[model samples]
Target: MTIRVPVVERILSANDQLAVANRAQLDAAGVFSVNLMASPGAGKTSLITGTIQALQGELRIGAADGDLASSLDADRVAALGVPAVQINTGGTCHLDAAMFQGALSCLPLGQLDLLIVENVGNLVCPAAFQLGTHRSVLIASVPEGDDKPYKYPPMYRGVDALVLNKIDVLDAFDFDVDYFQRGVQALNPDLAFFPLSCKSGAGIEAWLEWLRAEVRAYKERRDVPGNSGTDH
Candidate 1:
C-alpha cells in the first residue's frame, strides 16, 4: 500500500498538467465543457439525449463518451444531430486528461458552444482525475438510495453540480429527497442542485435555464482581464 501511494500521486500530477493544457485549448476556442459522472444506469446518456433534444436549435453541442467498451453511448448522442466522440477506456474505470485531450482534437472545438464529456460509469475513480471541463456534474437517481452521498463522499465533494435523475419515480420508490440533499449539503454546501427526470422531463426546463445562464456568464467572463473565477 505504501509503495503504491507515490505512483498514484505521480500519475495524478501528470494528469493535472495535461488537464491544464486541455483547459487552455478550450479557453482559446471559447468553448464551455462539462464532465458528467455517474454510476452505471444512472441515466447519463438519457440526460445527454434529453439536453441535446431540447437545446438543439439554440446551442451547438458536442459529446465525448468514455466507456470500458462499446460505442452505444456515442451513437445515441450522435443520432440527435450533435457531433459525438467515443473514447474507449479499454477496461479502465475512468477517463484521464490525456484521453479527453485526444477527443478534443477530434472535435471541432471552435464550432461548438457546449461540450459535455460523459465520464465512465463509476462514482469513485472519475472524481480523482481532472478532465479540464468548465464544470463537473454528477447524476444520482431516485433508485440509487439517498445514502450514496454518505458512502461516496469524495464524488459528492468534488463535483460542481449535482443532478438527481429518474425523479419521476420518486413516489414509487422509498427515497427521501431531503435526506439526499442534506447529505450533499454537508459535503458541498454551495453545490448547485438540479432535481429532474430525463424520462418525464420534470424540472428539466430549470436545468436548461441554469445551463444557458452558465454559458452566458462564462462568455462574459472572457472579456474581463485576469478573471479569477473557477468555472468548475
Candidate 2:
C-alpha cells in the first residue's frame, strides 16, 4: 500500500514556507509587521485607525486590510492618509501567507517603519494561518462576552498580545475582566494585555507606546550583525 499524507498537512507546510519567505522580505526592508485578528465588530479597523492616528508623524505605517469582500476597511485606513491595500479573500475566512505576499508588494515597504495587516474578521480561521509578522495580536471586545477566551482557546493561545477592546461599554455589559484574564493566562501566561476602548480613545496612549517600543526593538535587533534575518 502507498503511504498518503493529508492534504491539510501539505497545505499548511506550503503556507509555512511562504511565511518564511515573507518574513525574510520584511526583515530585509527593516519593517516590523503585525497581524491583527478579531471577529466581526471586534474593532480591528478601529484599532488600526486609532494606531495610525496616534503614531502619525512618528512612524511611516502601512496596512493591509483583509476581508471577504469590499474595500471599506482599506478606505478607512487610506482616509487617515496612511498607505493601505485591501485584500478581498473571495469568501475565504482567513488570509494566508500567499495573500500577504501579494499585498506586501503593493505597500511601500522601503519607506514604512511598521506594517499592520488587519486580517479577516474571523477569530478561528485567522489564528490558524501565519502571515510572517513580528507579532500576532487578537482583539477581544467586551460586548463579545468574557467567555471568549475559554471558547476560543486556539486563538487565545496563539497570539502574542491581546487587545481587550470596547472596555468603555463594560458598565452596560456583564463582562468579568478577572474571569477573562484568568482564562487567557491559562493559555498564555505572559501574553501582553491592552484593555482599551477604540470608540472613546481610552487607554490608546498605552497601546501606542507599546507599538512604538516593539517597533524600535525590532529595528534594534535587526541592526545587530548576523541577526538581520531572524524573526523573534
Candidate 3:
C-alpha cells in the first residue's frame, strides 16, 4: 500500500497571514521598515549602528537585532539611545515574520519614524524570508570575494539595495571593484549598490542620503490624504 504525504500549504498560509498583519501594524504606525541581511562579520551591526547615529536627530529610529545566541548587537544599538529589541533565534538560522511581530511589539513603533531589522547573520536563509519589510539591504564585504552574487543568487535577487562593505581592505586583498559590480548587475540589473568602508567612514554619505530620502518618501506617502492606502 502507498502512503500519502499531506501537502503543507496550510503551514505557509498561516505564515503569510501573520505577515499581512505585521505589515498592517507597521503601516498604521507610519514606520519605514528595512531588513538588513548579510553574512557573519560582514559589518551588518556596524552599518546599523552607524545609520542609527546618523539619523538619531533626523528621525525617530528603532531596531530589532537578531542573532542565534547573544544580544550583543542589540546592546550596541540600545547604547545609542534608540529603542532596540533583541530576538534570539535559539538554534534557528533565520527570522520569520512571526518573530518580527514579537520584536515590533517591544519597540515604540508608533513613535518610530524608521524601523531597521538586523536580520540573522546568514546570507541565504535570511533572504528567503520576507519579514514584511519595505526594503531589504544585503551587505557583502570585500573579504567575502566578488563571486558572492553568483554563489548566493537568492540573497542578491531579493535585495532592494546592496552595500559593499570593507572597501578599505581592497589593497590588502585581491578584490576587484569592477568585477564585483558586473557580477551583481548580472544578477540584478537595477540593484542600487554602494561601496563603503564602515570602519573609516568612507562612502557612507551616499547611503545615509539615500535612506533619508526613502524615509521621507515613505512618510509623505503614508501621511497624505487621498493617497493610496499603503501597507509598507
The CA lDDT at 52 in model 1 is 92
Error of 2 at 218 (Å): 0.6
Per-prediction TM-score to the true structure, in the order listed: 0.96, 0.96, 0.93
RMSD of each: 1.5, 1.9, 2.5
TM-score of 3: 0.93
Q: What does candidate 3's lDDT look like per residue over 90-169, in tens digits?
A: 99898889999999889888899899999999978887666888889999999989888878999998888999999999
For 129-225, candidate 2 gives per-residue lDDT tens digits of 8888989999999999999999999999998889999999998999999999999999999988999999999988888988998998888887888
Q: RMSD in Å for candidate 2, one decimal?
A: 1.9
lDDT (CA) per prediction: 0.92, 0.92, 0.87
Q: Write the residue-wise lDDT of candidate 1 on 1-232 in tens digits.
A: 9999999999999999999999988998888899999999999999999999999999999999999999999999999888999999998999999999999999999899899999999999999999889899999999989889999999999988899999889988889999999899999999889999999999999889988888888888886888533354
Clashes of 2: 0
Order the numbered candidates by TM-score, best leading: 2, 1, 3
